[model samples]
Target: MLTSLWQRLRADFAMLLAFLGFAALSFVFLKLASEVLEGETMTLDRWIITGLRSADPTVPIGPSWFETMMLDVTAMGGVWGLTLITLFVTGFLIVARKYATAGFVALSVIGGALLGTGLKALFDRPRPDLVPHLVEVSNASFPSGHAMNSAVVFLTLGALLASTHRSRRVRIYLISVAVGLTLAVGFSRVYLGVHWPSDVVAGWCIGAAWAILCWITARLLQRTHQIEQPGAVPVEEEGGPP
Candidate 1:
């Protein structure tokens, strides 16, 4: 009884933390959006965007190799790259017979993408004209698709994969990598003059909130056995009778 009570308490605490995180991120995103609509962020956005460029403003302020590296990093957050990653991860999960988890990952990524698209359309903000774009782009750009989608895909994958591990170090490593990738991608968008800094911040806020919401839902499903529990070992792997 004591052990069961402790487990319940831990679960409750985790859920509470998730809710708080989601709320905080959502609030930030909303506030940022309002400021953006009022054109309050434009000055700072232009300053940051132009600062990343050379005096000419057409070229980024970096060595050729550095610009190349940024392009490579930004590509990771592009639609085709994210799609391939999601499909590969989902395929791995299915092959492991974790069908529920696979489906959950697929749905979460797809839903987040669609939500991002709708938000972009709603905002209908234009790309930065402060500097010549280092990368070709054609879309509404209030919230960067690269930043938002990268956050969703990377963070969701990190959380899901971390749940399957028992080591605290491993979990931290996975989440840190996810965050690093997300941040790098966001920064690349700005450095390349393809998005305003505010757009990247807004994307991070909403994407993180969405990912947290999905995590909360996943925890609820796990509690109900609608999905596999964290660190659950397959019976076959445990040498149980087939």
Candidate 2:
């Protein structure tokens, strides 16, 4: 009884800390974004975007090979790519008899994408034109859609997969890959001259907050028996002769 109580207390404390951390991050990012939208951060935004370009405004700061690599990296965060990945994972979960988990994954990614779209429309910030864009883009850029969606999908997916495993190292590896992908995609946007640094920052903040909230909600549901724990071990029956 004592052990179980201690475990529950530890879990609750962890969740509380996560909530506070993400909340603080979201506040800071939104504050920065508000300043940017108010034109208070225009000079800083322009400086960072332009800094990624060569002396010749048309050329990107990096060599030809680097540009190609960034474009490839950016594509991983694109809508079609993320959608495909989500669908594939959802299908896999269904096949594995984890229906609730499948629904959660679908809801998390689709909801985050919709939220990103709504936020973009609300802010209606224009794409940076100070430097030539290596890739074509047409949307308001207050918060980077690619950056936000990638963070949401990757982090949420990472957390879900990590939960199924019992190994600490495996969990760390999954989360590190998710973080790495999110950062790479965000940086690729800046390097390709499609988004301001502040946009990516805002995206990361909002996405992380959203992912963490979803995780907390899922845990609550599991505790309340609203959903079966995806990582719960199945009980085996005693055989007649073994």
Candidate 3:
């Protein structure tokens, strides 16, 4: 099984390349964030101090109802309540050793937390002082943890569920949910005035890279399991199935 998975990965060379590409992209984001977002927590911080006040938001979907609903979901619920709820749930699943699914979920939550915290510490950025902060926060805010965590958890969990099943409909549903939720979370950060547009963008990129790494780790661990098991020898590539 280990050999088979390795063969499979090599057979589709593009997949591995994608992983590297995302990591590189995330590194670039970090560099750019450090250079561009220096001591200028004015816009997002100001908005956070004041309150969410959209002059105009582009309509989502075709109908006004859909657009309105998305605004609320992404801006308020996702950034504040929903994001934390998902993190706790994912952590529980991981602690229970429901790997693959649990790893997928945990990667999103823990990875986001770590990445967000690391970035904050690296830059030592300051929070906004424009408004009265309802929630107590001590970290700097370049890449919003809420945005990053939400993106990873929803997207990777969706991918894991899709992969474990062999149904096309299930895959589509899972992927769609992931995309929608991630977008919602990102939008929420911007809408709720806690993050800048750039912060959200960086969060999305970092979250994606971290999630992919988790997937790769899970795959490698699975391979190790097969190798450690008794009598689970690898078969030679006898031109049977390349």
Candidate 4:
């Protein structure tokens, strides 16, 4: 009984820490976003954007290999790329008979996308014209869509999948990959000179916060038995088709 109580206490403490950390992160992101919207980050944005370009100002600074690599990284955050990942993951979950998990993943991505669109419209910030864009872009740029959606999709998917695994190392690896992909996508936006540095920062902040929020909500639902624990074996109905 004592050991069980101790484990419960540890689990509760860890969750409390997570909640607090996420709240702080969201606050910081919102603060940075507010400053960006107020135009306080313009000077810094210009410096970073210009620094990434060649002396000619129009050309990107990196060598061909690096640029080529970044293009691949950036594409992973793009619409079709994210769509494919989402569909594949969701489909796999459904095939495994984890319908609730699949539904939550789908909702999280779609909701995050809508949030990104609304925030872009709300801010209506323009793309960086400080340097030539390495790739074509046509949208408001306060918060990068690529960055936001990548975080939402990758992080949510990672966390959900990680819940199924028992190994601590495996869980860490999953979360790290999700975070790495998010950071890479955000950096690619700035490197391509289509987004200001602040834009990517804001995207990272908001996107991460949204993913955390979704995770917390799912946790609460599980506590209330609204949804089954993620990664648990699917329950077979006695009268249902196998």
- Which one wins on lDDT? 1
lDDT of each: 0.92, 0.85, 0.59, 0.85
Candidate 4 per-residue lDDT over residues 148-183, each given as its tens digit: 899889988887777656678998999999999999
TM-score of each: 0.95, 0.92, 0.62, 0.92
Error of 4 at 169 (Å): 1.9
Residue 33 lDDT, candidate 3, scale 0-100? 77
Tens digit per residue, CA lDDT, model 3, 1-242: 99999967773574577578677967967675765457444555455434444333222224557545655666433444655666665665555444445544554566666666787677665554443332345666767676676666666666554544556788789779877887787775555445556677777777777766655554455456621211122444466546
Order of quality (lDDT): 1, 2, 4, 3
Task: Estimate the overall C-alpha local distance difference test score of candidate 2.
Answer: 0.85
Clash pairs, candidate 2, are none
Give the Cα error of residue 6 in candidate 2, in Å. Answer: 2.3
Worst 10 residues of 3 by lDDT: 226-235
Q: Please report how far candidate 2 places residue 3 from its true position, in Å.
A: 2.3
Off by over 4 Å in 1: 236-242
Error of 3 at 145 (Å): 1.2
Model 1 agreement with the true structure over 33-106: per-residue lDDT tens digits: 99999999999998898888887878899899999999999999999999999999899887777789889999
What TM-score should be assigned to candidate 4?
A: 0.92
Residue 194's lDDT in candidate 4: 85
Candidate 3's displacement at residue 185, Å, is 1.2
Indicate which candidate wins on TM-score.
1
Quote the lDDT for 235 in model 3.
43
